[model samples]
Target: MTEAITVMALRQGVYDHFREEGDVFEIRKEDDFSAFWMVKVSDAEALALQKAAQRQPEASRHVVDTTVIDNSELEGLRIQLAEKNAEIERLTRNVPGKQADAPEKSAADVLKMANDPTVEFMTFKAAARKVLGDATPSTKAEIIAALEDKATAP
Candidate 1:
């Protein structure tokens, strides 16, 4: 059963009943610009009313579908990233301005390159290997003699 009560006509007992029985009946306030009525509804009636409200055109206008995925932009970005990486590798191949086919350095040139402060350590090691047949030299004089021998050799 359902009943309608006005805010002006509501008694304390109605408030007490609703407080003690938590939402056993759904109450909705209806107003037509003049008077308001508190209408009590059953559970089934409340569910039906809610479903009807969701089916209204005004409710559908608030929802948007945004589930579309575009992979072309992502693929284009990946291609551009790969091209940039390749360009970096190509530019760095001759980074020290040395060519792969440069002629082998003579003993005097090797000694000069080894003693130069601005040369990289790898060049010093290469010179040592060329003169001493090993990457390390025990004494500075031994390396110097070895370089002089190679310089005088045919």
Candidate 2:
């Protein structure tokens, strides 16, 4: 059951609280109460809401231990970084060109490659794999020279 009360004096301040906390939800549609707005609320709910309306909202913020949280979060990040590095190593273990055992031609030999026009240098391909993957490592010597130039660059 529901009832209408002028409570006009109290209505102004409590309307917002009632709407948020309880079911004083919508204003009535009937053509009446010209001076003040009519909010429809259950008598039981209105009583509780009215009491809540009188009290001020609690002023407080949640307390957190930032040092503890930050340390834990950083530990988690470190673990993830280690896992990612391990995964990268695992994935790249068989990726053709990264073998440490592959033979490396000397700087002098690679440098003399400038004289060999048949030496083909692939832009992105590694010297070792280019020999096996393609017909031959025609330009690796030139690429090695370029690499050495960049390495000794000022």
Candidate 3:
């Protein structure tokens, strides 16, 4: 039987970077436990990548050990990982609830506000004030034209 191996790291980015480097792997992000990458990598390659990742400050705390286990042994480990992730999600959800009463702004609303002509004009006027200060007629006309073009563009 092909041996199953699992390794954990501090950040998903490290795993993603390694995967992108042509490594054959399956990665899963867990909210409770550290994120992991599972693969059939040669022991040398795994150790090398683990050490390299550990050199970075953010990934230094990662536990970069691999286990050799039967395929059947993974089912229970997967289930437990799922349960732990669910619990982590639940706890994280509660944290944001405390701040929910604060005013919330959607991305669309912010974009619309930014695109408002009055707001755009104010921004342009402020920038022009800094660059052109007491603007000449030519500079004023240029600013107006630029602002109009920005306002009209999709």
Candidate 4:
């Protein structure tokens, strides 16, 4: 069997995609500030992980380390991580809610999002605020025009 590897310091966007795919991954660490994660995988899966990481828009390259553990140990680790995650969520459930973060987007990015045929008013408004730091125009055409203007600005 191929050796297992641990890929460290992954960006949050990348981790979000991986978190849903339960097979072939075990998250070992997470940092909220930089949104970095550490995950365990087989060397056999490392190439696929690298390709997936490469697809992430704003992530840096990750360093891989050898991970030595028997199957039982790996399972134990996953169970522990999941329990910790559940407990963390439970403890924080009563805290005041904050707005969900919009990914770091530029005017051009918001313009591209605005161009989506299915873009909703509230979605565009939130994206516009993130990109433009102000209220978005009320109408789609106006938002598109404003985004275009920003995209073309010096």
After superposition, which runs of candidate 4 have C-alpha atoms over 4 Å from their true positions?
1-103
lDDT of each: 0.56, 0.50, 0.49, 0.61
TM-scores for every predicted model: 0.40, 0.26, 0.22, 0.34
Q: In angstroms, how far off is 59's CA in candidate 2? A: 21
Candidate 4 lDDT for residue 71 = 88
lDDT of 3 by residue, 6-32 (tens): 443333435546433323343343332
C-alpha lDDT of candidate 3 relative to the true structure: 0.49
Q: Candidate 1 residues 2-92, lDDT tens each?
A: 3442232112224434322112233333431122223455557666755765676653433343333358866897999999999998987
Q: Write one digit per residue (lDDT tens) for candidate 2, span 74-150.
A: 89989999999999999998875577776764444544454567754442334433433443334655455555664
The number of the candidate with the highest TM-score is 1
Instruction: Tell me the spans in candidate 2 whose CA falls farther than 4 Å from its real position.
Output: 1-69, 104-154
User: How many residue pairs clash in all the candidates, one count each?
Assistant: 0, 5, 0, 0
- Please tell me which predicted candidate would have the highest lDDT against the true structure: 4
What are the root-mean-square deviations of the candidates from the true structure over C-alphas? 21.5, 17.0, 17.8, 20.9
Position 141, candidate 1: lDDT? 62
Which runs of model 1 end up more than 4 angstroms from their true locations? 1-71, 96-99, 120-122, 130-132
Better of 1 and 4 by TM-score: 1
- Residue-level error in angstroms, candidate 2, position 102: 2.5
What is the C-alpha lDDT profile of model 4 across 57-154, one tens digit per residue?
43233333225457898899899999999999888766522334434778888787776878776787777876666567777788778888888999
